[model samples]
Structures are given as C-alpha cells and as structure tokens.
Target: MSNKTIKIGQLDMELQSIFSAFEHHVHTAVDTAAEKTAEEAVKKLKKTSPKNKRAKRGKKYKNGWKYKKTSEGMTVYNEQYQLTHLLENGHDIIINGEVRGHAAAHEHIAPVEAWAQDEFPEEFKRQVGKG
Candidate 1:
C-alpha cells in the first residue's frame, strides 16, 4: 500500500474564498433590504398620514415623508415638516389655560414598525437566499 498525505492548504484557501464571497453577498443583501424597508415605510406613512385641510395645494403633509440611509441603517422622516412627532403622539389642544380638547394620535410609525417586524426577516432571508 502506498502512503498518501492530505494537503489542507488548498482546502483552507478555498474556504477563505467561499467565506469572502458569502460576506459580500450578505452585505449586499442587507443593504438592499434596508433600502426596500425604508421605501416601504415611507409609503405606508404617506398612505396613513392625516390630511391637512388647511394645507395649500403644494404643501401636503403626506408629501413630507422621506427616508435616508445611515451607517447603521435607514431612517424615515419628514424633511419639510417637523410636526410628525406631535401628529403621531397627539397633544391637548388647550385654550386660555383650560383643556378644550385633545388631538387624537394619527399613527404612522406603528404600522411601519409592524411591517418591518413581520416582513424584514423574511425579506432579508429571501435576499440572502436562505428563504
């Protein structure tokens, strides 16, 4: 019988290449997923936003929703308007130190949150070819 020795150097190199490829794929998939999520969130926000009756023809609250990508992830926000937080959380419409009424919260983020929770994992999985 002839003695045979296994060479692990080639196997290690092949594994390294495979891991590198996998890393690249994962990064690309995550970036794509993030962008999609942001876009979907903005769309949902716009669809669910409360219409401002007093808004001018070119100044609609729904059109304020926008998104941007950050180093950690994507963020959905209103670039032109700053009342998103108040609109989402609601506030007491007080007059002359007396509580006249309350403005009900018009939720937009909650739906987006639910959507991301329910859909993000699957989307990421699909993108990464694990679905």
Candidate 2:
C-alpha cells in the first residue's frame, strides 16, 4: 500500500479564497462601483448647491461647470428656467434647463428674455444693469 500527502501553502489558500470571493460577487462589485461613482458626484454637487431657500433652482452639467447662488433658489430636475451668462452678452439672455449640464446655448430659449425682462423685476434689473 502507498500513502501520499498533498499540501497547499497558506498564501495559495488565501489567494484561492480571494479569487473565489471576487468571482462570487463580480456583479455586485460592478454595481457597487457604479453606485459609488454616482454617490460621489451627488456629494460634490451638494457641496455647491444652496442649502434651502430657492423658489426655483437650476443646474448646469455641461463641460465642467460651477454654480454659485447669490440668493436662495429651488430647482426641479427636468424643468426649464431662465438663465443669463455672467460672461457672454452677445447672445440674448436665454432660458435653459439642467438635464446633464450647467446652462448653455444648446438648451437656450429665445422667448425667456422677454419673460425675464417683464416678470422678474429684480432679476431683470440686475442683469440689465450688468451690461
């Protein structure tokens, strides 16, 4: 009769366990990674948004943008609202929405200029005075 013993090292056993665990949770790992990325993005956004004082608010997500509220505001994600650029005036003041970016010309509304000038007295004054 012959007898033989097979031995696996501690490191090899640990590696096997880790690989098995990783394989078992592969789908969860991917989902968790995506969720974490989204969570981080929201956290970054919360840092910049006004705490709680907007009758209305807006977000712009185009090409690395930032928003600073001089006054209180509120926003509903898909709703379009009026916006004026701080740097550009050649184009008429436009209306925009926060789909995935900060305000830009692509979502601009031509009629919003009239509304801003006529309806939002204070906002209209400030923007016009800026010119």
Q: Write one digit per residue (lDDT tens) for candidate 1, span 1-131.
A: 23545478776876687788889999889888888888888888878888777667444678788889877688888865677787889999999999999999988778788897787778888899852
What's each prediction's TM-score? 0.82, 0.27
Off by over 4 Å in 1: 1-7, 57-59, 96-98
In the range 48-88, model 2's lDDT, one tens digit per residue, is 43222344433342213222222332111211222323212
Model 1 residue pairs with clashes: none
Give Cα distance to truth, residue 112, candidate 2, Å.
29
The 10 consecutive residues of candidate 2 with the worst lDDT sum are: 73-82
Q: What is the lDDT of candidate 2?
A: 0.37
Report the Cα RMSD per candidate: 5.0, 20.2
CA lDDT of each prediction against the hidden true structure: 0.80, 0.37
